[model samples]
Target: MTGTDAKDDLHQYLREAREALLWKLDGLSEYDLRRPLTPTGTNLLGLIKHVASVTAGYFGAVFDRPFPEPMPWIESGRDENDDMWATAEESREQIIGLYHRAWAHADETIEALPLDATGRVPWWPAERGGMTLHRILCHMLSEIARHAGHADIVRELIDGSAGRRPDNTNIPPLNEQWWLDYHDRLDRTARATRA
Candidate 1:
């Protein structure tokens, strides 16, 4: 494949992961969006919020194209892991808006620069701070995909919803009883391991 093709494929995958993460929030109430469904306080809105900040930094600051707005939660360190979740005052529109803007900024950077264009990551060790657009893209893609998986689990815990995205469930279309029996078989196998 050509260099451009590789970049496009990577960008497309990143975009899908970003959309999948955001899609998990649809039709949910504010309480449900912010409510921690996992033991580590993982929630739908928080996942989006955290990704926005990280995405902006990697695609914005890393490439010398800064995001237009200030992210005090990430920049100022006002609260620990503030980016990991949304605050009561932060509306759904606001966080989602920021994420969209970050995507635009990242896209511009990706478009303007070549795959080998060098950039420094300030957060990384001095010896390994320098990186290329391709490397950063791969890293961010992995990061977003991992968080998207987390969003999947958190959403499932909230309302028994499970899928790759809203339009694509990507799972076998089986009856409810089939799922329950499959789950039971897995449970029994897990128990048998310790017996």
Candidate 2:
């Protein structure tokens, strides 16, 4: 792909991944959002909260602009893991709303800078000599895709739902007997391995 085309592709991929991450949270109740779905305490709302911090930090604070609001615990060193798991102080609506706003702010940064425009990352000065807008955009896209994959697994565990995106409708319905057959296959695999 040409330079411009590749840049456009990166931006499009980022938007798609971010949307998929948010879509995974749809139709979930507050309790469902906060419920730990993995051994490590990853949950739907927690994923959204992390995205908000990363988005605002990388795109807003990195650029010397103001983020919309404070992440109290993150700012105060209450719990580092709070970034990836919901806390009692955080609400599903508040985190998700902040995430949406962060996206808008991040989009504006992407729009204002050309792919080759450079920025200084103060925290990573020793590692990254300087960073291009293209690099940051690509990195954010990968970050979103990574967390979205986590969201996909957690969502499926919650309600047996799995798909590439929210609008996906291509999954074939399975009957109870089909599930039994699938389980039987799994049992056979376990037995063979145990033996």
Candidate 3:
């Protein structure tokens, strides 16, 4: 494939991962969106916030095109995990808006530079500090996809809703009874194998 085609393909997958991550928030109330379903305080809005912060840094600072905003939480000497959860005052709209802005900033960096364009990740260890657009794209893709999986579980716990996106369930067609039987069979097998 040509260089432009390769970059477009990578960008497309990155967009898909971003969409899947954001889709987890649809049809949910503010409380549901910020509710911490996991013991580690994993919430939907917080995930979006964290991704925004990281994306801004990776695409902004690393590429020497800093995002035009202040992010005190990302500064040194701040509380740990500050980016992973939203404050009560931080509304759902605010965090989601920041995420969308981050997308635009990241996209600009991607468009302005080729995949082979080199950059530095100051937060990384010295030996691994140097990186390229291609590497950062893959890193961000993995990061977003991992959180999207977390969101899948958190959304399911908040309500029984699950799947990849709103328009596409991406799961086999099976009735409720079929799922129940499937779980029951697995339980039976585990019980039978118990020492």
- Top of the candidates by TM-score: 1
lDDT of 3 by residue, 27-133 (tens): 99999998898889999999999999999999999989999988888899999989998898888988999999999999999999999999999899989999999
* TM-score of structure candidate 3: 0.95
Each candidate's clash count: 0, 0, 0
Candidate order by decreasing lDDT: 3, 1, 2
lDDT of each: 0.92, 0.82, 0.93
Which residue pairs in candidate 3 collide?
Answer: none
Candidate 3 positional error at 161, Å: 1.2
Q: Estimated TM-score per prediction?
A: 0.97, 0.86, 0.95
Worst 10 residues of 1 by lDDT: 73-82
Could you tell which candidate, 1 or 2, scores higher by TM-score? Answer: 1
> Where does the lowest 10-residue lDDT sum fall in candidate 3?
164-173
Candidate 1 runs further than 4 Å off: none
Best by lDDT: 3
Q: Tell me the deviation in Å of residue 52 in model 1.
A: 0.4
Superposed model 2: Cα runs more than 4 Å off: 169-176
